[model samples]
Target: MNREQPDPPAGGDRIRQTAVRAGGDVIGKKVEHHHPAGPVTALHALPTPPAGFTGRDALLEELLAAVDPTTGADRAGVVVSAVAGMGGVGKTALALAVGAAARQRGWFCAELFVDLRGHTPGAQPVDANAALDTLLRALGVDVEKIPPALEERAAFYRSALAALSDRDEHRRPVLVVADNAAAVEQVRPLLPGPGGHRLLVTSRSTLHSLAGARRIDVDVLTPKAAVALLAAILGADDSRSGRTEELAEVARWCGYLPLALEISAALLVRAPHLDPARLARRLAQEGRRLERLDDGERTVRAVFDLSVQRLTPGQARVFALLGVNPGPDIATEAAAVLTGLEAEEAEEVLQDLAGARLLTSHPGGRWSMHDLLTDHARHHLTHHTGTEVEAARRRLLDHYTRLTADAAIHLQALPGEAVPATFTGTADALAWLDTEFPNLSAAAYAAQHAGHTDIAVALPLDLGVHLDRRRRFDELISLSTLARDTARTTGRTKAEAAAWNNLGAALAGVRRFQEAIEAHTTARTLYQQTGDRHREANAVNSLGAAFLEARRFEEAVQAYTTARTLHQESGDRRREAAAVNSLGLALAGVRRFEEAVQVHTTARALFREAGDRHGEAMALDSLGTGPGGVG
Candidate 1:
């Protein structure tokens, strides 16, 4: 057997740990440092979970949907899920339940479970090569004959597993459960190639980084459900079943956590003298009651410690910084700003944190720790890292402001002048706007709170085109009003005109023409007030269009004529021609034959001079079929 540690980057690699698994809780001293190097030629297939555990009906359905056989090989694709919730949430129990359920359903030819030990304090994760070696052996490879080097071992591992799943597009079913993984890459090498087998993984952290993987958010068990679970575990015979209600109190006190409940039950077994009544009373204390309530070495803190202790200094620092973020998660870019790492490096670190079960990655690359974990991370940040918690938060918020402002501008405007967005992830970008829609509104509200009136006004105005395209009319109304009020607050003349114009357009899209005309008139008035002659002309032009649509011909003529005078004054002959065209169309509506002909004639000459063939043709067509033919 050859032993060399897995080559983790300078401070980011692996070391072995020896922890005692007491009642499925990892408990033990930290092993002296040794790299968890290359795989063992010797192999051992692991034991499968026994049948029957409660919970996870919803999880199983989602997983089955993700890996449906009708979807065929993709069904056999990696299904990474996180059983994330507070400390007492039944994440591990849910994993065990799913395992038991999968076996009970007879879905796989064989089953294997390996704990990646990502969240364990000092426990080193099982390496991919070592995992594959064990997989091949479990599939019945002889220890002496197995290959040694990484490449050969992987090939043999893939080949030996290939027997269970032929090279054909579809094959036999096997289910591999990688329990408690720390990263997307770590679980990658062990994936059985295009086999009929499916892998159902359970982790404390969300694994959204894994494409085509199903994510199931495990929450606290319901009060009724928790009571039922304790009843099933701690029944004092049929006669003493009145104590079912007592277990309910125990469940809540333990935070409806399945692991905690199991431990609470184990303690009752360990101490025969303690009554369920007394145990419930002891757990009710507000202090660090976790020590008293724990099932044994498998307390929530203990489970977390194994994963925490395994981290190198840098990875440890990242976990600490993330705990202070305001929201449940931060985008990878924001995390990069917080950690002073580049985006790619930040993503890799996030994956490590997630794989270690110290943090969770959500659908849009947002990272968060379980609430209790965040509290722990905050404590560590205060005492260990020299970086200020507030400083990291301030930097993250600044980065978010810059990114969101940039994105808003890119999303707005006609494509002619706007920059093409180079998004980190196209799927991620869209999902970020969608998932953070509420947060964006809150951000707008926050800008006002910070007394940044210009940003408050400009940010919403910047979103006009995208909102129009998306038809989020209600949001448009809200944002438009925010822009309008903000500009007013800052006495920003140009911004007032812009916001009023946008509000008018948005109102018009919803067919509130009267409100649009009123708003457009307000914009025109503001432009005129500010002596912004060019914007005044443009606003008048918009007003004319609206009047024409509303069948107010006389009003339309007045607006168009005013615009024509301004364009003429500005020497913008093309716009001058457009206004003359509008005047011609309005004149024809009122049967002013001679004036209409005169207007069309001017428009034709201007179009010809401008080399606008299409406009010239339109003018010629209108002039010919008019009430009075052009002389």
Candidate 2:
């Protein structure tokens, strides 16, 4: 440590001056600056303590990869590693150690630590702007000049950190550590310029949601590391003097948790007269039972419990309900339904949990708790009453009901067909539909079992348009089967007919002509049974299309003629035009061009009268000439 005092600044000069940095650590040099404010929170201490800090080697590699010159055309910019893991798993310890190691290797000019207090549980997370204020003031920025808005504060933080980084690009470098981050959003504001600054963040969960962020998941220290840490704290000579079992027992009892080891060592230091073997026996008796090892008021469980208490009733409900959410991660939309809150509110809650380092957000915006945290949260919220569970299920069902209905209406809109304006948002509704497709199928299946027959039948009908757009014919077929089964169960002839029509369309799109014809024939039977003559004609028309694709013109013409008679009798001009167009094509295929032309001419006239431009265009293209020309 440098013993020389920092040079005193001139009187009345409020702009406290500090070293901007000139690359590489200046050994034994102390930066002279007037800190405009008192230190906010002295970091827990440098990484001088002994800890194994397991599972971070892979994380360090990821961080290095981000700044690897080969990436992004071989340029140099500081790589950001959000060191996230469960509480008491040594995020801060790992970060401090890495910073110290970087300094020893001359990779940085200096290192600074900022605790964002993201995991303080009951305490509100430190605002981004406030963190900036502390950092800027610490770096010699005037306290009164700090920006109030979070965005502006962030800009200033980047600029200030960048100035030091730029100073390092040519000479030495300074790496900054912003630890205990609350969320990606909070950290995003403080990220140094994509230049020389290396940021290492430690949190309780992975920060994979941050684009380009390198994630390091910290777990308990290895037993070897734990023993090493014990020896470091309790004295290596004393530890190895034929009483190693105490250290090993202490390490094991602490779950190899570094923080717990430190506390245990503190206890040992204060009670040196106590026998080591007796201490080991005491710890052993507390097997798997975590005693409150808080130093007066700071215990790991207390820290996490406070955060849990800060969650809303709905958020708390989701945190508990998701204990049973089976998967690696659950999408935001599914989580929203799992909780009773609206999608937006549920998303906000997830953001809160993510910021608090209780959850990890993934690509495509799904989130999950760390394995350790997940297990603990499940244990924490085990008091969910039976009534609460039922209420949650009801909310979930309600959410799916509106979601599926909205999807159905949108599907109807695909052919520019009019559907009721039931849903308030089209974009969000469609996205929800897309993200929840599998869950929707499962829900539909469950609904059918629960006697929600129409819901089971209609959801697939709603998704038909978009799924067709993606050419998911197999999924469409599966959906149609559910609809058909539900309709049969409920004795709903119209729904059954609709299911057949959907099935036929899916089969036709995939060129499964025989299956397509069978589906259409089934739809025709159901439509006729319901006395929906025009619908029956439409089914016949679909069968004609399948036959046409299969090169069965005679069968195609027979189906088209039957459809045309029904359309003409019903005065359904659009259906009449379609039937005529099909009949003409069937005739043309059979080398009867004259009849084909005549039929197409009649179809074109009807399409024009109906004001259907697309239909009229098709009709005009079909005759292949004007009224008097050849087909």
TM-score list, all predictions: 0.46, 0.50
Writing each residue's lDDT as its tens digit, candidate 2 over 179-241 gives 777676667666665655656666655666765555556666777777777676666556342
The residue-by-residue lDDT of candidate 1 on 1-631, one tens digit each, is 1101111111112211111111111111111122232333222223332222345567656665554444555443554454443344555555555555555665555566665655543234556665665566566554434454446776786677666555324454666777666776667666665656566666656766766565667776677776666666545563323477777777666666665555565455434565667666666643254466444323455434434545677888788887645453577877898887899999998987765556656656777555567666766776553546656755655555555545443432221333336454333444456455444554565566656565577656655544443334446677878888888878887777767776765565455779878987998899889997866776776676566556566886798899889878877565566567666766766778788888988987876776555446656666655323333
Q: Number of the top candidate by TM-score?
A: 2
Looking at model 2, residue 237 earns an lDDT score of 52
Q: Which residue runs of candidate 1 sit more than 4 Å off their true CA positions? A: 1-54, 58-254, 258-330, 338-340, 356-359, 362-440, 548-553, 571-631
What TM-score does model 2 achieve against the real structure? 0.50
Candidate 1: count of backbone clashes, pairs at least 3 residues apart or interchain = 20
